[model samples]
Target: METTSSVADIQMVTFLLGSEEYGVDVMDVREIVDITDVTKVANAPSHVEGVIDLRGSIVPIVSLKKRFGLPEAAAGDYNCIAVMDFAGALTGFVIDEVTDVIRVARRDILPPLELGSEPWMEGILSLGPRLIVVMNLKHLA
Candidate 1:
């Protein structure tokens, strides 16, 4: 069977975080869930919002805004939790909105080196007039 590695493209799940567009490898995403109540954990990392009971499993939730030191999403803005497997663990990250699932060609993706040292950025892809930031999800874990 032909695989993603055998192909010239990668499928990415795009989402919004504070007006910025970000994308991650779709294969790593477990599911996307509506925003849920999170029980705050004491002494947890600053970026960690808290934990949520997903079915019978407890999943830790991290706020991308907080992790990146960005301003919080304004009140009444819709948010969702992106459950992805990263850094050897399954973590849920809060996102502003899910935009699309796109097949990005390797030739269309530019290495982050062009933008200098941005540890959290994996690659950059331009879609018409919009520039999509492909993120290194592993860094969030």
Candidate 2:
């Protein structure tokens, strides 16, 4: 029997939050769902939007705009929830829009600049005229 391991390439689910583009590893993302009603949780963190019953499993939702210190916008038609597995727990991130699934070589990802530290930003990827900020989902949790 020939056992072959899959090579790890940088695969990301890209999305838009405000005017900026962001991405998370494809492995971390479970699925993307349309913006739905969220049951508010009392005394929850400011970034946490609320919880949603997704197919019987209660999934906590977070506003990436609030997490990134961006101004909050009313949920529009393009808004979506990016369900992700963070440290074994399923969490949903509310984003403006999901763009595409991009595949780039690991070597193409550039280390983030050492300015004000952003713990959630994993790295930066230059895709033609646009730059995508790859995020670390564990930090969001």
Candidate 3:
């Protein structure tokens, strides 16, 4: 069996989604901000939570959990918005908490195993003792 390497090998920003660890390519992330009140929009998609006044322009927010069909995270706890610019669109993703910025090299990344009924997991990447699930945020948008 191939062993999982250290988190240092993955070049990414690690964050918590409930108890599971997730990562995204560092270049995609723009900034992190604490959770703030978002103005709800009418007739918006179900996955779209709302939009926030990010500086001068309104940035749309998406519930990552909802997008992935995961349970909604409870309020009044550690919450953050990871802002990313993808394909000329600026969107924010709500996460449980921001963890660390580590570098996991491409060599350490493993292909997705053929599970009988795995959900929409992007792929697997080494992160210390455990394998972190890489999420495809572009698909979420």
Worst 10 residues of 2 by lDDT: 1-10
Model 2, residue 22: distance off in Å is 0.5
Model 1: how large is the Cα RMSD against the reference? 2.6
Task: Tell me which of candidates 1 and 2 scores higher on TM-score.
Answer: 2
lDDT of 3 by residue, 21-114 (tens): 8888888899998999989999998888999999987999988777767878766664899998755688888889878887766666676688
Best by TM-score: 2
Error of 1 at 140 (Å): 2.9
lDDT tens string, model 2, 1-141? 533323547778999988899999999999999989999999999999899999999999988888889878865644789999987899998989988998887778899899965988888999999899989877754
TM-score of each: 0.88, 0.90, 0.82
Better of 2 and 3 by lDDT: 2
Q: Ranking under TM-score, best-scoring first?
A: 2, 1, 3
CA deviation > 4 Å runs, candidate 2: 1-8, 75-78
Q: State the displacement of the C-alpha of residue 37, model 2, in Å, after optimal TM-score superposition.
A: 0.7
Model 2 alpha-carbon miss at residue 5, Å: 10
Query: Which rank order by lDDT, best down to worst?
Result: 2, 1, 3
Error of 2 at 83 (Å): 0.3
lDDT of candidate 2?
0.87
